[model samples]
Every structure is written in C-alpha cells, then in structure tokens.
Target: MSRKGLGLLVVCLMALCQPLPSRAAGPLITPEEAALPPPKGAVGVDRRGVTRGPKIELVSGSDIASLPTRFQLKFQTFGGATVDLASVKVLYLRTPNVDLTERLKTFLQPAGIDMPDASLPPGEHMLRVDLKDSDGRAGSTSFILKVAR
Candidate 1:
C-alpha cells in the first residue's frame, strides 16, 4: 500500500482505538442506605445491597401429633436454605381433671426429657412447641390432643 494510504489507515485506526471517557461513578451508598431491612417477603440480600429473592416458607412437620404412641416433630426449611433444629421444648398443658406434670412427662419424651411410660386416662391436653434454629431464630406452635381410655 502507498505511504499516504498507510498513514491515513494508521490515523483512522488510532481514532478508532482512542478510549472514550468513562462515565462518572454512580452515587455513593452509605451504610445507612444499605442498612434498610429487606422488603416484606424478601428472602435475602444481594452483594449490591438489593433484595435477593422471595422469602421461603419452612415446613416443620405434617403430623405434629399422633395417638398415645410415640411420635416425632420433624421440621425443615424450604426454598431459601436449610436451617438446623437446635432445640425444641414441648409444653404439655393438662385439662381440668388431668395431671399436668405426670402426663407431660410421658408425652414429651424422646425429645429430651426422660420419663417412664404410663397410660394416660381420658382427658384434653394442650401441647405447645417452642423450636429454636441454629441461627438463634425461634418459632412456636401448639397442638391439642385428647387421650381416651
């Protein structure tokens, strides 16, 4: 190619290669701005301090109670992440004619307490469960059971 043509080509290339000035940085977000709580139903936050996604519903158990036989209260978190079941406390409320302490001892075993097995007479009872997760988040639920002879 001719020297003039090469020079023109070089000039055009240089012009094309020149970098455009970068846009000014976006407005700075202070800690106060980032400290805003997640919107209702938001599960978590993103690295850019925006809401990540929707809140996840946790499944504790299907049958929280059963017959006079042994039963278990299982739980699990859905969608977001699995949370550990740290501790569970069962509050057994006795009916007007039933023994509170004795019956509770039998019903809330296997979880943590140790009690001797005994037949419970017909009566109404209130079972309140307090569950704490590994992250220190706590939740509670209740159940009513009637034992018939």
Candidate 2:
C-alpha cells in the first residue's frame, strides 16, 4: 500500500486499542429522586435567578387507587427550570365538597414531586396544575384520579 494507506491503517489500529471514555448512561432523574419533594434533590435552577415553569410529566399512580389518602403520583418537569413558587398552583378537586389546591401546595415536591399528605376517601377527582416562569410564561396540565377506600 502507499504511505498514506499505511499511515491510515496504523491510526485505525491505535484507535481500536484505546479504551473509550466512560459516559453515564442512566436517566437524569431516578425513581427515588422523583419521589422526593420539590427540588426533589435534583438540580433545576441556574446560577441566575431566572427559571422557567415546569412541564408536568406523569410518573406513577393509576386511574384507580386502593387508598386516595396514600395514593401516590409521580411527575417530572420539561424545562430545566426552577418553578416559580409564587406562581405554582396544584389543585385537587372532588365534587360535592372537595378542593385540595391550597392544602397540597404545602407538601409538594419538585419535578417528579409527590404530595406530602394526600389522604382522601374513595372518589373520582380532578387534579389541575398551573405554573408560571420567571419570564411570565404559563403552562398547565391535569389528570383524573379515582381513589378507592
């Protein structure tokens, strides 16, 4: 072979002999991390104070739950932005006499967050979440939950 061909062959051999760099191939946030409260033990905010609203990502919980009181739902945010605390709203509504919006806020986790004290009776309920970013952008999401006593 020509000198160019010989040089190329040697380079390829050397590359094949070298060990590849190690890179993490795991999910950014694990199930355990998602189970934690807001900030949920994961990094979301930047050095700057600005943060974008979270995009809700459902993780767990089913249409029906054996105990609404202990029913668990998992969620993750889209943007790598810290949620606006003042603009964060989580509402749990049940017909006839049930609204747990304000009450749940006190026990919310970060993206992939969970309600701290969610004890409710058997019933069908609607959960609505509204969030606002530091830039004044808004996003909303919801889900239907059926709790069984």
Candidate 3:
C-alpha cells in the first residue's frame, strides 16, 4: 500500500483500539456549561466523547426567558481524529441577520475549547455544526435552542 494509505490505516486501527485520554472520561457537558433541560432522546457518546451530535436537539428546558446571556458549547472528536477549526463549518439559521459560524470557530480555536454565547437573542434558533477531522472523519449535529423572553 502507498505510505499515505498505510498511514491512514494505522490511524484507523489506533482510533478503533485506543481509549480516549483520561480527560475525556467524563460527561460531554459538565453541569455548568449550560443549564440543559432533561435529556429527551437516547443518550450515547460517540468515539469523540460527543453524546449529543450527528444531529441537533435543543436542551430540554432551555427557553428564551431562562436562556443565559452567556454560555459555552464545546466540541471534540476522538478515535485519533482532530478537526481544523477554520474548516469546522457552522450554520446558525432562522434568526435575523447573524452568522455564528466564524464566531463559533473563534471560540474553539483560541483556547481549544467550547464556543461561547455571551450575548444571544431570546427565541428559537436553528444551529448546525459540522466538523471534519484532519484525518477526514466527519461528525455533525443540529439542534434548536429556544430562549424564552
């Protein structure tokens, strides 16, 4: 096999066999990230420690009124997969003139952490996040977050 192809195969094997580092051994979201409502759908964490991904779901109780003006949304991928933040595309639609894609990338790239929503409108929003790892592995999730006013 070509060196590049062989290398990818090695990566794939490592990804399948290796456990995530200790840092990722916890819940996808800590209790403090955002006050998520009860989990509505089934819960399972993928190789990336992502329990909520590949699809979108609003945090159960998050509504316009109770939605915090400030919050964090984190992203990660395991199985030896790493994403390029700039290449990590996002689509924040259904709201007025605002594109959060760049903002989200900015949030993850600097500290290598979650995206922060410090100031957001209180209403229903459709947010989509698509991540492609450096190895070409991809995962995405889209969900609605409603802020009650």
Candidate 4:
C-alpha cells in the first residue's frame, strides 16, 4: 500500500477503538439517581437578587411517558445581561443531588438545550435547573418529570 494509504488506515483503526459518547451509549439518568429523595423546597421557577436572573424554559412536555424522550429547554436573560452558559447546572433533585451537567453538555446551546433522545428511570423525577446571568444574578427552575411505570 502507498505510505499515505497506510497512514489513513491506521487513523481509521484508532478512531474505531475509541469509546462512544455517553449520549450514544444509553440513558442519561440511572435508576439509582431517579430513586433518590426530592429536594427540600417548592418545585418551580425562582429568581435571586434584586436584578433579574436568567430563565430556563422547558420546551418539551414536563410529563415524560417513556424512555428516550425528547428533551428541550430554552434560556433567557434579563436586566440587560446575557445568559452565562458556563454557570448552567442540571441537578437531579435529591438528598445529595446528582449533577447531570456533563452528560447533557453537548445538548446545551446559547438559546437553549435540545436533546432528541433522553431517558430516565420510571418515577416522578424532579430536576433543578440553575444558571446565572453575565451580571452574576442567579435564576432557578424545577420541574417534575413523570415517567410511566
């Protein structure tokens, strides 16, 4: 084989050996995470500081019937500030709380998050979405995801 052809073959082999991304592997939330106790507080949108913070809107239906459901969220900033994407946090509301930011990072966007396929264990799962604005104002929102038994 030509030298260039051999190099290309080697690169393809290396790529095949790499593990697939989490999104491709399976569900984003595990059974254990879903079974944890809910956080101590009301479940809804909240804002911190006199200045308004960023907003997280759940574009998809809050009630999820089955696995591999479409998950969509939109972000909005206020008070002449922009949404601080880096400050975004997706927490599985529980006694200890599970951070799902890393798993959902790829789906995140400046305007919102769009996950064509997402899965969670069967139960009523409460998720807390928290983020800040460029001005450092904090905003939070929580919603219950009801997965069919």
Candidate 5:
C-alpha cells in the first residue's frame, strides 16, 4: 500500500480499537456502608437518666410561643468506634410552613461545625439529624422539637 493509504488505514484501525464512551459509573460502596446500619437501638435519655424511648420530648417551659429556646439531645452508642461528625446536619422545620434555614445558619456559624442549616421558623419544628462517619458509614435520626419563638 502507498504511504498515505497505509497511514489512513492505521488511523481507521486505531479509531476502531478505541473503547466507546460510557456513562459515569455510580460511586463505589465502601466497607463502612455495610457496617453502619440504621441507628439501631436509638433511645433519647434525659439528664436524669430517664429513658424517653424513641420519642422527642419537650421541656415543660418549651412552649412554641416562648422565645430564645434551648434544648439538648442525648443518645448512647457502644465504644471502640469514632465518628467524624463533620458531615452531621441538623434540619429544623417548623409547622404551618416557614423555612428558617438561613436564620439557623447564622446560629450555627459560631459553632464552626460544617452542618446544614435549619429551614424552619419559631414553632414546633422537626429536627432531622444526618451523619456520615469517617469510614463512610451513614446514619440518620429525626425528632420533633418546639423552637420557642
């Protein structure tokens, strides 16, 4: 074959040998994905060590109509493990429909925790906690909270 014809043939063969483009594959599942199951054995306890079961409890004075609210959440877990907690997110949603995410952003800014801000108003709000561990293990929990004022 002539030089130009041989070059053209080589180019065609190379093109045919190339692999076809494919859609990006999904993310790989790591070992952590198999280890951390849904937050099993979840229980909320009060300061007095009283188990509240799997329910969100509001303090006596935690009326939605009140202002400047403060509350705490308590849970237990076995040792011999660690969590990054950097990916933890707390979403607060108020009833009757109001998104205070931005407001909560400012509230959490000083804390320096890289978490999603709440998008709810002052009232009975739902607290959604999403967490991913250092090994990529993931778990989530949610509870109702009264955001006073």
Candidate 6:
C-alpha cells in the first residue's frame, strides 16, 4: 500500500479502537439493592401543609423502563414557596429503605431529578423522593419503575 493510504488506514483503525462514552458511570440500582425485601414501614408520608406545599412530579415516557433509561422529575411549589433543593432525599423502598440521595446527588437539581441515563435491574422497583420548600412545608412522591429482563 502507498504511505499515504497506509497512514489513512492506521488513523481509521485508531479511531475505531477508541473507547466509546458510557451512558452512566454505574448502575443507578444494583442487582443486590433491587433484590432486597421491602422494609417494615416503607410507606412514605407526605408532610405537606393542608393549605400549600411543594409537589414532585415524575416526567417520563413510561413507567415500564429499560436499562440506562431517562429519569426526569419536575418540582412545583404552592403558596409562592420554592423548592429547597438541598433538602432533597431519595430512598429505595426496600428492606431498611436504602438511602439513594448520595448516589443520585449529581442528578438532583433545583427543578427536580433529571438523570439522562439511569440503570436498574429487571423487575419492579419503587423509589420515594422527598423534599421541603422554602416555607418548610414538605412534599413526597413515590415512583415505581418496571424493567424488562
């Protein structure tokens, strides 16, 4: 082959060998975590005031999801109160109710959770997200994600 042609081939090969960008660094919910049994009191109670409180809304294409799926949530507040982003907490509704706040900190935002790519094991999984508003009124929401094998 000519030197020019060989160089071009080598460049193409190098580009092909480069690693592709990952959707997510790691699974949002590991297999073991998903396998855990439900906690004794896994129910999340809303502490929102009768008059007004913050609201959490799940915004996704479907409840049935696949691995590395887009997970988006929108927050709304009542009585002119704004969401207190720092008070956000995420819990995996399983035995002992796993705290996923730290793991999902990167995806949590002032608006709400906006994870472009979140991975979870197959089966049904539940998540409880809670947050407070500037007025100290609390709001919580439960989300069930069903994944296929």
What TM-score do all the candidates reach, one by one? Answer: 0.35, 0.48, 0.48, 0.74, 0.35, 0.73
Tens-digit per-residue lDDT, 1-149, candidate 6: 99999999999999999998543535778999988897675543544446577888879744654567887889888777888988999888997678888877777777887888787888877888889999998888886777877
Candidate numbers, best lDDT first, in rank order: 4, 6, 2, 3, 5, 1
What's the CA error at residue 44 for candidate 5, in Å? 14
By lDDT, the best candidate is 4
RMSD (CA, Å), each prediction = 26.0, 14.8, 15.0, 4.7, 16.3, 8.4
Q: Which stretches of candidate 1 lie over 4 Å from their true place?
A: 1-68, 78-86, 94-119
* Candidate 2 local lDDT, 49-131, one digit each (tens): 33354556545554545432333344334455555657766554322223344555544555434543344434444566666
Per-residue lDDT of 8-56 in model 1, one digit per residue for the tens?
Answer: 9999999999998542222112223224332343222112223222112
TM-score preference between candidates 1 and 6, better one:
6
RMSD score of candidate 6 (Å): 8.4
Clashes of each: 0, 7, 9, 0, 4, 0
lDDT against the true structure, each candidate: 0.38, 0.49, 0.48, 0.82, 0.39, 0.79
lDDT of 3 by residue, 49-78 (tens): 534222222233244464234334455555
- In terms of lDDT, the poorest run of 10 residues in model 1 is 49-58
Please tell me which model should have the higher TM-score, number 2 or number 6. 6
Question: For model 3, what is the alpha-carbon lDDT of residue 130?
Answer: 67
Question: How does model 6 score by TM-score?
Answer: 0.73
lDDT of 1 at 81: 34
Quality of model 6 by C-alpha lDDT:
0.79
Estimate the overall C-alpha local distance difference test score of candidate 3: 0.48
Provide the lDDT at 59 for model 6: 90
Pairs of colliding residues, candidate 5: 100-119, 100-120, 101-118, 101-119
TM-score of 3: 0.48
* Root mean square deviation (Cα) for candidate 1: 26.0
Candidate 6 regions with alpha-carbon error over 4 angstroms: 1-25, 40-51
Candidate 5 Cα outliers beyond 4 Å, as residue runs: 1-65, 74-79, 93-122, 147-149
Alpha-carbon shift of residue 66 in model 2 (angstroms)? 2.4
lDDT for residue 48 in candidate 6, whole number 0-100: 47
